[model samples]
Target: MKNVTFYLDFVSPYAYLAFHALPQALEGCSYRMEYRPIVLGAVFKANAVPSPAQQPAKRDWIRRHTTWLAEQAGLTSFAPAVNHPFSSIPLSRMALACSEDGAINRYVANAVFAHCWEAGGADPLDLQRLEALRAVLHKQWQPTIQSVDDEAIKQRLRANTDAALATGLFGVPSFVVDGELLWGLDALPMLRARLLG
Candidate 1:
């Protein structure tokens, strides 16, 4: 089976779109995906660039583009986060807290993504919403909810971010297959071709 490393941050709309599109995009491919949650702001800083959201016009364009992309992909539930460039650190740590090693559980990743994108653009970091999420996750795995604040989980997220940069990945929704880096939701077709070959 082919191995794919999926790097994402919940703040990225492209990541949200790509996450939901992956299943069908490569339907018959034999692959295993390892999800890596990273602090996208760190990546921007390291790359000496500003987030698109920091640019008014580019941010607006992406908001529209991703919305249209979602509709085209038949993702009826997709919605932008109310805070486009909100701190993804807490959610990333929360996700890692539930993870084993550096590979996050797909279920946990999905839950986080849905929390960011599916709640009518609500802020995922809002106390009430986070508490609700904590409650839901508590039922799924008791330890997960409790571990989000652990120092180890926070460090792991940092390590993952460092690792991503070392591997030359600079954006969300990136896929690494056979050591080749592919970025963006638009890379799915190239990823499919790579996987099929």
Candidate 2:
């Protein structure tokens, strides 16, 4: 069977970490991750919990904490988005569109991760970046903000977030395997184990 579905957002550091860890953790496992972009902010609002970036102290701690987690996990450098808490709608919309594009979603995911995590994303969800990504993915995207403002794209993004909640997701980088939900990068080892079993 193919891999479990991974729900994520560019605004989430944990999601960034998970993208790096999953391949190794699931090595030799006959499963592939189906990536779905969802706005973590919407998930937070649904759960009645503010995103970590919404609070100064929590945002500061997430930076420090993920750095330490990265070191322990022997993963890449954890560069928190220079533009923490930027609206992820544009990125999310592009991802939703890529979902229907064969194999283009992989490139889209990589581009989003690189921009929001490693590259010091001082401008989150910048429309130009989305347009560029759309071009590379061979999708049609207007250069203006209207590119992502289409009602269908907006609804698709909203539906993705709603699907995440229906699966009991409370955060980004969550894996849904056979109806069992695993949240966060820390769950990778457990995910590997479950995949084996």
Best by lDDT: 1
Q: How well does candidate 2 match the true structure in TM-score terms? A: 0.85
Residue-pair clash count for candidate 2: 1
lDDT scores of the candidates, listed in order: 0.86, 0.75
Clashing pairs in 2: 3-32
Instruction: Report the error of model 1 at residue 196, Å.
Output: 1.2
Best by TM-score: 1
Estimate, for each residue in 74-191, the C-alpha lDDT of model 1 and write its tens digit.
8888888767868888888877767767678778889989999888888888999987876666644536445677777887888888988988988888999989999999999999
For each of the candidates, the C-alpha root-mean-square deviation to the true structure, in angstroms, is 1.5, 3.4
Deviation from native of the Cα of residue 165 in model 2, angstroms: 0.8
Candidate 2 residue-wise lDDT, 1-197, digit = tens:
64698888878888888888877788988886778888788788889997788799998888898878777877574567666877777777765555542122566787777767765445655667655666765553333335556776777777777888999899978999999999888899989888988
In order, how many clashes per candidate? Answer: 0, 1
Give the 10-residue window scoring lowest on summed lDDT in candidate 2: 96-105
